[model samples]
Target: MARTSIDYEDVYQALPGMVALLTPDLVFADVNEAYVRGTGRPRESLIGRYVFDVFPESVNAPDAKNSHHLRASLLRVLATGERDTMPLQRYDIESPEHSGDWQEHYWSPVNCPVLGPDGRIRLILHRVEEVTEFVRARGLGGDTAGRVLEAELYTRARELQELNTRLREAHAREREVALVLQKAMLPATRQMGHRRAAVRYRPAVGALNVCGDWYDLVDLVGGHRIGVSVGDVVGHGLEAAGVMGQLRSALSATSRVADGPGQALNVLGRYANVVDGAESATVVTTFIDFDRHVITYSSAGHPPPVLLHRDGRVEFLDRATDPPLDARPEPRPRPEASVAFSPGATLVLYTDGLIERRREDIDVGLRRLADSLSHHRELDPEPLADTVLRELLPPGGATDDTALVVVRL
Candidate 1:
């Protein structure tokens, strides 16, 4: 019996497909023999050069978008750590023997990211399959029927690319409108008398930068009291965002006139029954009375808030838990609870995205949050909020929206 020694470099060079490795900055790191042969470029000359600098766009073809498409695909791979398959492109390459002469080429290109051990993108793998011969054959007049079919195919692909571009532009415009509406709906954090507070809101990564999560800090009627709340509508995107705005506004307005957190949420629950897309939404609200040194809280099927004492004790305010908004057939009074806290204690209110993870028990996430809070208990409100997010969220970011409010009492 014998074992064969394998040279990976040899395998890479011998690959049948044209392949090249690029640094995150788009500088060529290495290229396979197939790539070198396909591009008609020497290995020594191509390596370590910027991709675009070596293969500049054809100056004669002013209407061509080959470089723009390739650059955009590569940059998207870097940004999203995902593969991008570009539409068939006509890229004119300079003739090897004739200086300043360009030869028309068509290619199907794909760009993929190579991740490092720590989950960061380290390199981009650029692969291209040349379709120049097929494309040119389609234009030959002798085979009129084939020429017509191939021309139709090319036209369809180009039309599809244009349609995709327009769709992306439309999505961008919608996202902008949603973000403006969301910001207008959510209020800025107001001063909490002698207490310090920090708030953070992060939308799901791919949901057009808009989501149903929201957080609010309100100065109650009395100067010494402040109200903090975090909530999540069941869905994501523009419709959910609209529902979130209504619910958040309702809760905010109700908190001002209602007797306590319970009454405010009860009013919100009744309102959610009529609001479209607000069923099964979750929310938690806390009113801190600095004058009385007491905290009254209520929840509508939301995760419990964390109360961290100056001495490093962690407490979950779970006494007032209830079903999500509009969960019951008939309207009922929401439950409320109160807890007394000493000066210098910290109160953390958050949406479920702060703790929930795929396929993992929620208690584990809760314990992890509690441990992180206890370890970083000495930090002030702002840094503590950041630290909590850094410690709890996945490196790639959460799939759901997250809203957090940290208050130092």
Candidate 2:
């Protein structure tokens, strides 16, 4: 069936959007009142005229986009049997009723083939929509995105600040308990005339703030040796600290009977494995016998103590170690290594935290500590250890906690 042309004047007045019927080559076969008002032209000027000639605004050379890509889009529909949307400019014309000279417009151009009495495509329908007010009224996409980002940043900052407060309180409380418990498990601070001790403890860095590093010195009756040790139990928090306390207690009691470095560590390993009636893994330990001339030491997987000789030579001294005491049902046999102390030498017994840094760049930190010890040969053990902790370790609290036992020979 053919689409008979209704009364053309009545159909023109009925259209809501700017509507027109075009020939295959852009000749205007018919148009509506809305199209006349949008283009600001008299209806007589447009009817039966070529669309390009009447509305020069919508025409462009084949290579260039016209004012709003209106000409190109109509060409696309004809070539591809498709429709396209366009925003304000040439394709859309403003209504005469609106006062604002500025327009925000959109064009939804549709080309439908109108059949003739012969029943094949004869004319094409082109519809243009003007949505100028809608476009101009809203904010820019970039501006809206910035506002949302700022709001999210504010939320994140608030969450971070609250977390920091909670962390500080929790860490302060844990450190208080850990410090008191750790100090109580060992003998009271006593300075042996032959040995001056300097100890420093700080919480771990970041929020967790737990450490399990401990050291002790017991003055033996025979003036035979200084019973010094450094030990690490397991992890970074209170559990490691608690295990350290149990081991420290066991070391103080057992060291009284063991005469040699190897014997002392053997006793410690056995006791740590069985303490509290539960057999567990062995903690790595270093026990030192500091007599005036020579220092004998035994280790259980602990890093060797660095000896700072009075002549500015540095040496890390320790024996080959078996695994930790509680690693198995039966502990690996302990080993001992001895070195004669350089006159006025300072021995540094430390945990991994002393040299370890984030990103595993411990070699650089080791060199710094070794260089510091070599450069400052005359500084006493107490001040020397303090300086190393303050300068060589990462600033503020450490990523892992550090413990140091400095004995001078």
lDDT of 2 by residue, 1-409 (tens): 0012246568667888988888868788888889777667677777788776665552222332343365666676667655444333323344456744433243434556564535444677878765444434554233343344446556876999999999889888987886677567544445667666665554456523345667778755455566777776556566766677778777776777677667777777777766642233333333444545677667666666787888888987745555555555665557776677754677777776777654456577677778988887677767877887887666545656677766666
Per-candidate Cα lDDT values, in order, are 0.86, 0.63
Clashes of each: 0, 6
lDDT of 1 by residue, 1-409 (tens): 0012456788899999899999998999999999988898999998899999897776767877778889999989988999887777766778889999888777778899998747999999999888778767767322343355457668877999999999999999998998798779776655565678888888776786668888888878875888899998977788988998899888989999989999999999999989988888989999999889999999998999999999999999999999999999998898999999999999999987888876678899999999999999999999999999999988878877898899999
lDDT, candidate 1, at 230: 90
Worst ten in a row by lDDT for model 1: 140-149
Which residue pairs clash in candidate 2?
A: 104-132, 105-132, 210-236, 281-326, 282-325, 282-326
- The C-alpha stretches of model 2 lying farther than 4 A from their native spots are 1-175, 185-190, 207-210, 274-292, 361-364
User: Would you give me the overall lDDT of model 2?
Assistant: 0.63
Q: Would you give me the overall lDDT of model 1? A: 0.86
What are the runs in model 1 whose C-alpha is more than 4 Å off? 1-156
Candidate that scores best on TM-score: 1
